[model samples]
Target: MNLALLFGEDFVSAEQAVLTGRRLAHLKSVLKVAEGSVVPVGLVNGDIGTGHVLQLTDTQATLQVELPEPPPSPLPLTMVLAMPRPKMFRRVLQTCATLGVKDIWLINSYKVEKSFWQTPWLSEENLRENMVLGLEQARDTLMPRVHIRKLFKPFVEDELPALLKNTHALVAHPGTGTPCPVHINAPATLCIGPEGGFIPYEVEKLVEAGCEAVHLGRRILRVETAVPVLVSRLFDACS
Candidate 1:
């Protein structure tokens, strides 16, 4: 963890906060902080700053915090993703957060397994935990929002059009003729598919909803690898 992320519950007063659990372990083991040591800290959805350790112990640490600097600007991108395999979902969530993607929609695709949605990682607590890790890694405090949509057709037909409004919309398909645009540096909505890619009918629906089908060359990448590659390609700020 690069920055210790503080939640509302961590605060005892306006300028004081307490750390425990994983963060305490990190302080003791990884950061090796002492009573007078100052560490980087940030409040969730708030600002980035530093915390001066006032007290340290095996179980908890008390710190005096000052938050004056705002977090990094969030990417003006809305990510519409096919539900990935349960094993890879956590990593993808972290990647999205680290890349500064503030809005994420996890929708169903033809190739997505129904069981993927059953993963515990999708739970609110687990989701927050993974996103927190990502935020800490990036030294960012603004939390990303994740929207779940299990029905593909309804999402595409009823919701996606509105979501794509005033944004450059594209779907990343493997064999599409158009290369994914680079450095657009503007608001965009990007759709990515599951392991085998979206079925033709699903792609057609997304196309009808306003997304231009685009590809990332001939090389096939796993969802985890493709997400960062596509985000970096689309936004120079991320690179």
Candidate 2:
């Protein structure tokens, strides 16, 4: 973990926190931190700063925290993605958070398996865990919001239009006429399909809902691969 992400429960007082579990193990085995060592620390959805080790033991480590700096700026983007395979979901969500994507929508597509939503990774606890991993990797503290929509048409017809308001909306689809724009660096809403890409009807619905269909060249990419490429191409805000 690049940064120790502390939750409200991890704090004992305004400036003190006790680390246990994975964090304590990381300090012991990976960092080999001793008393008086200062480590990078940040509170979840709060600030980025440092923590001075006040005590270190086998079970727990106490730190005096100083949160003086704000976290990195988030990307002005909202990601609307078709649900991917269970095995790849956690990695994709973490990657999105790491890339500074603050709003994510996991919607159903024709190619998406019904069993995909059954994955434990979609649970609130598991989602937060994976997001925390991503935040730590990026040294960011702002938590990303994940919205799940199992019914595709209702989401597209009812919700997506308002979500696209005042934003450059695009759907990444292979074989499309328009190439994906680069470095728009403004608020945008991007919709990506599953492994096989969205079916014609679904693409039509999204386009009708305000997204301009665009392509990322002839080579079709996996959802995980396309996420980073698309986000980077659309924005340069990520550090």
lDDT at 162, model 2? 100
TM-score, model 1 to reference: 0.98
Local accuracy by lDDT, each model: 0.95, 0.95
Which 10 consecutive positions of candidate 2 have the poorest summed lDDT? 230-239
TM-score of each: 0.98, 0.98
Model 2 regions lying over 4 Å from their true place = none
The clash tally of candidate 1 reads 0
Residue 68 in candidate 2, Cα distance off native in Å: 0.9
Among residues 3 or more apart in sequence or in different chains, the pairs in candidate 1 whose N, CA or C atoms overlap within 3 Å are none
Per-residue alpha-carbon lDDT of candidate 1 for residues 173-213, written as tens digits (9 for 90 to 100): 99989999998999999999999999999999999999999
